[model samples]
Target: MGLFSKDIKTMDDLFVHQLRDVYYAERQILASLPKMIDKATSPTLKQGLESHRLETETHVKRLEQVFEMHGAEAKAIKCPAINGILEEADDIVGDVDDKQVLDAAIVAAAQAVEHYEIARYGTLIAWAKELGRADCAAVLEQTLREEKAADDKLSAVALGEINRKAA
Candidate 1:
């Protein structure tokens, strides 16, 4: 439902559509991460967010390469799923007054984002392989690995200290 609708009659069109969806999601994350970093109280959380931001920038570049390889111009279709997640995160974080709790909330929000990216990349990689674009699949698998690592990092941080500190 992004800039195009009902016209995706082929797997290639579906693949390209998803690529645009993730591209939009990544850009939204790039904008949202700075705010998450600023609101984070824990040094570790802030550092993690910063590191992820850099990784996200790299993800964007990789996505661009994928688009180029596929012969499509890199474009973003509005991703309402990511938009809703980000909005919900802002609402939840804004409601918290405790710094420790806020840090935990940030981790939760970040994990949500990571999970979303992982799902998207996973599907995209499978589709790439199905379409015989091993190159695209390889690139996407790298991003999926990074997303899972980031999710695991967030979980560890939350479970090891952030949530307990909040309580």
Candidate 2:
């Protein structure tokens, strides 16, 4: 139960709930990255996925810290956005046969995931600060910044060459 529910009725409860949502989302991404990496035709894109996988592990650890800081057990609320994105990626991956087109699909799917993470982390950082946990905000900000960088890196690879090849 969250702050709005009968169980938890504080800003902290709401914050932790949101935190757990992203925590679960990140773990889901981590589990999915390997499949994306294996399917990626571009060396750079594969490396990017692998790197993001590592970063996600770090992100999970940071969330654990936030949980500890809040005196709550680390847990995850279901995140439909992530589930939907991953399911879409699976569908796209299945539909493509050409390596070039598949690479494009993977990149597009990855950007979707990164963008979702960026939005969640951005919101969590602001919420953490609003809840008077600047320390937690700082940790979250680190993950947020990385998510943006990863997105930018994917865009660069796509715009620089991958999308043109696919087209």
Candidate 3:
């Protein structure tokens, strides 16, 4: 459903729908990361991509458990924001000839994605707790923590060398 769609009947419904959105986004990230790894010129970027890919898989499994808890099918809603982000990253990376600059671009694109995820997961956790679904909140909390760590690592990569190269 589009943002601000009147079809959302309750806070619970909106929460679940957004959960599905990020669920889809995470799965897409899982698929796109390996390609990002391949495109990365820096060994550090490649390794980071690979590590996050594995983490993404675990994330998907956790989301599956959340779906079961919510008694909702673990199906994905189309998340255009994430799709656009991933597509843009691909387009930008494709156009770059400088490996260092490309790596920096990739890092920036990734941080954008991580920030989006952090926002979603943060809300999901709060909603879960507010709804008295502590189990769900805890489950989502794990993903939130990981998302934060990923963002921090990407920042370090950007500051350490990726930014240097891009300059």
RMSD of 3: 1.2
lDDT of each: 0.95, 0.90, 0.90
- Once model 1 is optimally superposed onto the true structure by TM-score, how far is the C-alpha of residue 24 displaced, in angstroms? 0.2
Alpha-carbon error at 137 in model 3, in Å?
A: 0.7
- How displaced is residue 67 in candidate 1, in Å? 0.2
lDDT of predicted model 2 = 0.90
Residue lDDT tens for model 1, 54-163? 99999999999999999988999899999999999999999999999999999989999999999999999999999999999999999999999999989888988899
Candidate that beats the other on TM-score, 2 or 3, i.e. the better one: 3
lDDT tens digits, residues 28-144, model 2? Answer: 998999999999989988988899899999999999998998788999988888999999999999899999999999999999999999988888888889988899999899999
RMSD of each: 1.3, 1.6, 1.2
Q: Which pairs of residues clash in candidate 2, taking residues 3 or more apart in a chain or in different chains?
A: 3-8
> TM per model?
0.97, 0.94, 0.95
**Candidate number that wins on TM-score, 1 or 2:** 1
Order the numbered candidates by lDDT, best leading: 1, 2, 3
lDDT of 1 at 86: 97
**After superposition, candidate 1 runs with Cα above 4 Å error:** 2-4
